[model samples]
Each structure stands twice: as structure tokens, then as C-alpha cells.
Target: MDVYAANMDRCPVYASFFGAMGCACAIVFTVMGASYGTAKSSGAIFSSGIIRPDRLMQNTLCAIMAQILSIYGLVTSVIISGNLVEKMALHTAFLQLGAGLAVGLCGLAAGFSIGVVGDAGVRASTQQPRLYIGMVLILIFAEVLGLYGVIVSILMLTRSTLGVTDCPY
Candidate 1:
């Protein structure tokens, strides 16, 4: 059989699935972050006795950031999936995998930070509302962490190359 020889010109349809998996990974990672943020922030909000229940929305800022992180992941996932070609190159597949990890891990880190800070910040704010601004600043910084990942992934996707650098001379 002649099927064992090297063939750089061929890309099987199954290769496309690598890109699909990347898209799925983005969604999964963001969802995990959102869940953690919501659960942690909700617990904090309830535990902190509220002198003014009307401002409960203020305490949910952390959860909101987490949700926004998920949105970022969603947008990236859409972009990757939309560009899915029938025969995905090996280089593109690796790039897709990197993109997914970039957003996923970053979102996870940002969400963890938000949950931790939100729990304490919300509690602190309930007692002394003057700390609201500082809490917001901290959350923004955490949000930026996830944004950095998104930016890097976008750059990687845009700068990817054709998969053919290993041909023997």
C-alpha cells in the first residue's frame, strides 16, 4: 500500500474537529468561571447583613464581571467557529488550541479573583459604603486580566501561518 508515505497536501475532514473543540473549550471555561463567581458572591451578599437592601445591586458587581468574562469567551468562540475551514491545517489546529487555553485559563483566574475580592468587598461595603470605589477599581483590574487573554488569543488567530514547515529537503 502507498498510504504510508508523507503527504503534506492532504488534510482530513476530522482535522476540522480540533477547531470545534477549541470553540467548545472557550464556552466551557467561561461558564466555569461564571458559576464560581455567582455562587461565591451570592453567599457573601446573603451573609452580610444589609442596612440598606436597595443597594444589593452594588454587591453584585463581582458576579457581573464574571458574567462579562463569559461574554468575552462567547465572542472568541464565535469568531473561531465562524472561520472554521473544512480542512483545518495542523498549524491552525494548534493555534486554535492555544486560543482556547488563553481565554479559558485567564477567565478562570479572573473569576477566582473576583469571587474572593467580591466576598470581602461586599461585606466591607455593607458596613462602610465609602469603600465602594476601591472595590470597583479592584474588580476592574481583575476584569483586565481576562481581557488580556482575549487580546492575545485574537492576535494569535490573526497571525497564524500555513502548516508546512517540516518538509524534508
Candidate 2:
């Protein structure tokens, strides 16, 4: 009877895990669509000169940064969800939260840097080839945040204690 009760308790937890996975998948697709739309719109505006070249570049950079962050968030969320389901342990939740926070902070910094440096690039691109080089540098730096987040998430997943035997189902 005790074993049966434990099994019954695990059922709802597993159900919630599956539900969260579905939600994460939805978020991933939504971000992809939004990123594509933003890119298309930015290109159209730039080609038509609807906005100043500098502003267009800045906007596009911001959109790209957003897309990168969203992709990282989606991947990390899926990984964390799998780890949580496997472990059924509380510490996994904290690790997931920490990773999420790291991604969010990185996104914020990237957005700000894009706004500032992107504007400058628009002004300098006409006279200097180095402007493009600087843009590349900024992009590389922005991407580092995503790398750190992934590393932290992997570390957490590796530390999870739950094994096949602990699974109630």
C-alpha cells in the first residue's frame, strides 16, 4: 500500500513535467517566428529608407540579440526540464532558475550594447572598414553570455542525483 501511494504521488509530478515541456516547446517556436518577422521587417525598412540607416542597423542588431537569447533560453529550458524529470529533486529547480537568470541578464546587456554601438557603427561605416570589424567584435562578446549559461546548465544537469531506480513510474 505504501508503494502504491508513492507511485500515485509521482504521477502528478510527471504530468506537470510533461506540461512544462510542452510550454517550453511553444516558447521556442514563438521566438523563432518573432525573430524571422523582425528580420524581414528590418530589411524592408532598410531597403526602402523608411528609417535612417543607423537606426535600422541598431534595430536589426537588437532583434538579432533577442533571437540569440531566445534560442539559448529555449535550449536551456528543455535541458533543465529533462534533468528535473530524471532527478525528481528540489536542487535541480534552483539550478534551472539560476541558469534562466544568467540568460536574462546577458540578454539585457546585449540589448544595451547593441543600441549604443550599433548607432556608432551606422555613422562610421561610410568612412571606415573598421566599423564592421567592431560590430563583429561586439557580436562575439554578446554571444559569450549564451555560452556561459549553457555551461552552467550542463553542470547542473550533470550533478543531478536521480537515477532510473528512483523513478516511481
Candidate 3:
């Protein structure tokens, strides 16, 4: 019985540690994705001979929005995981972590799509309808990632409920 109790104690600790690591991974991936998207978008604008001061400001604004969204996801994940682990169950922690990743990925996709579409739209406003269509499609596709994250979170929460232990706090 002592050995079994020791093992149970270790499980929660491991779960918490992994949950934190997962949150960190999500944050890193989100930031990298945002940076890549920003660079690609800005480079496109510059290459198109439209890198005027006004366009620079617009690009900067879009990048800032992306950063904000990514940071929000990171912070939210940390808080939610902590709360779920402390007040709910170990599995809840994993669910929160997964949800955070989903949200971060969605934000990354949105940032990239927005940057690309905005730059392309500005550059080819006078010459193309296809670009606009592509932008809409990308936005829709990016939103799908967020939806999947929500679904995963829901499943996690449901599973946690089925196997709940007494709350630590």
C-alpha cells in the first residue's frame, strides 16, 4: 500500500511537469509561427516595390496583433492548466494543455494568413480578384484549427469528470 501511494503521488507531479512543458512548447511554436509569417509578409510587400512608410506601419500593426494573440494563448494556458490541476484533476491539466496548443496554433495561423492576405491585397488591389478569394479561403481554413482545439478541450474536460479524484485545493 505504501508503494502504491508513492506511485500515485508521483503521477500528479509528473502530470504537472508535463503540463507545464506542453504549455511552453505551445508558446514557442506560436511565436515562431508568428515571426515566420511576419517576415514572409513584410518581405512580400518590400519585393513588390510597395514598401512605403505607410505600408510599413500597416505591416507593423498586423505583426503586433499576432504577437498579442500568441501571448494571450500562452498566458491563458498557464493559468488554466494550473487551475485545472489544482482544483480539478490530473487529466484536466492535460486537457488544458492541449487546448492551449490548439489556441496557439490557431493564433499562429491567423497571424500568418492575415499578414499574407493583407499584404497581397494591398499590393494587387488594382490587378487581381483571385488574391481576395484566396485570402477568404485562408481565413476560413485558419479558423478550423481553433475549432479543433475547442473540441479537444471539451473531450478532455469530459474525460476528466469521469475519473475525477478529490481536488487538491
Candidate 4:
């Protein structure tokens, strides 16, 4: 005889709260990161543009790269939010949280990397146009970090439908 209430197929209202917060976190943190990256890298644009105005468009790559991070977060948040149902399980909520956090934090990291590297790359390119290729490579690497997060979050989102009894372990 079980003394405590069996969680079985129970679907509590509180269970959905976590998923809701997760969705909010994904977009909020992503926007914050994109803002930071753009602001930090914009300085390089202003400084470098004065010397080599022709490369201003190329120098803007860093901020553009950083902004992609937020888009990833938005994608995942939408996926998670769409999955949210009236009878959400705890595990589903946790899954959303994990997905949201992964994308959001990764965005922050990508933003930081783009900001610093972009600033330096933009400045350097002003003096040496040949450095543009190297800057592209470095920015690509930084941008991929966010890609990894998006991919993982997408994979994690698949588990949202599982119920308590669905765990194999």
C-alpha cells in the first residue's frame, strides 16, 4: 500500500509554470546578450570607419553574428511554448527549463566572444585589409557555439512529451 499520493498520470497546474518561466528566460536572456554584443562591437565600427569607411559593412559582421544568438533563443522558446499543454508533467517543465537555459546562456557566451573579437578584428582590418579573412574565421567559430546550443535545445525539446512513467531508468 502506498502512503504518499502516486504521481502517476497526475498533471498539476504548477508543473506548467516551470515551462512558462523557461520560455520567458530563453527570449529575455537572448535579447540581453545580443544587446551587449552589438553595443560592445559598435565602438570598433565608429573608430575603424573613420579610417577605412569602405569596410564598414564588413566590420558590422560581429554585431550581426551576435544578433543571431537571440534568434536561436526565440526559436527554441517558441518550440517549448508550443509544446506546453494544459496537463503538463513535471518532467516536461524541467525539459523546457533546460532547453531555455542552454540557448540563453549560449547566446550570452556567443555575444561576448563576438563583441571582443569583432572589436579587435574590426580595428585590425582598418590597418590591414588582409585580416578580414581571419576575422571571418574567428567569428564563424564563435557563432557556431550558439548553433550547438540551438541544436541541443532542439534535441532536448523532443523529450517534452514523455510522462513520469516513460523513464526507462
C-alpha TM-score for every candidate: 0.85, 0.55, 0.60, 0.89
| Model 2 lDDT per residue over 72-139, tens place | 66776676566555434334444455554554444445444444554455445434545667765775
TM-score of 3: 0.60
TM-score of 2: 0.55
Candidate topping TM-score: 4
Candidate 3 or 2, higher lDDT:
3
Stretches of model 4 off by over 4 angstroms after superposition:
1-4, 8-10, 163-169
All candidates in order of TM-score, best leading: 4, 1, 3, 2
- Write model 4 residue lDDT over 42-153, tens digit each, in one string: 9999899999899888789889988998999999899988977666677888889998988888888888888888889899988999999998899999888888888888
Alpha-carbon runs more than 4 Å astray in model 1: 1-13, 161-169
lDDT of 1 by residue, 1-169 (tens): 3432343443454656877888888778877887787778778887774666866877877778879989878987988888787755667766787887888788888888888888888889888999989999998998898899899888877865543343231
lDDT of 3 by residue, 87-164 (tens): 334565666567667656666676666566656654663245355455545545654554454455445534644655
Residue pairs with clashing backbones, model 2: none
lDDT ranking from best to worst?
Answer: 4, 1, 3, 2
- Candidate 4: C-alpha lDDT: 0.83
Top candidate, metric lDDT? 4
Positional deviation of residue 96's Cα in model 1 after best superposition, in angstroms? 0.9
- Candidate lDDT values, in order: 0.78, 0.51, 0.55, 0.83
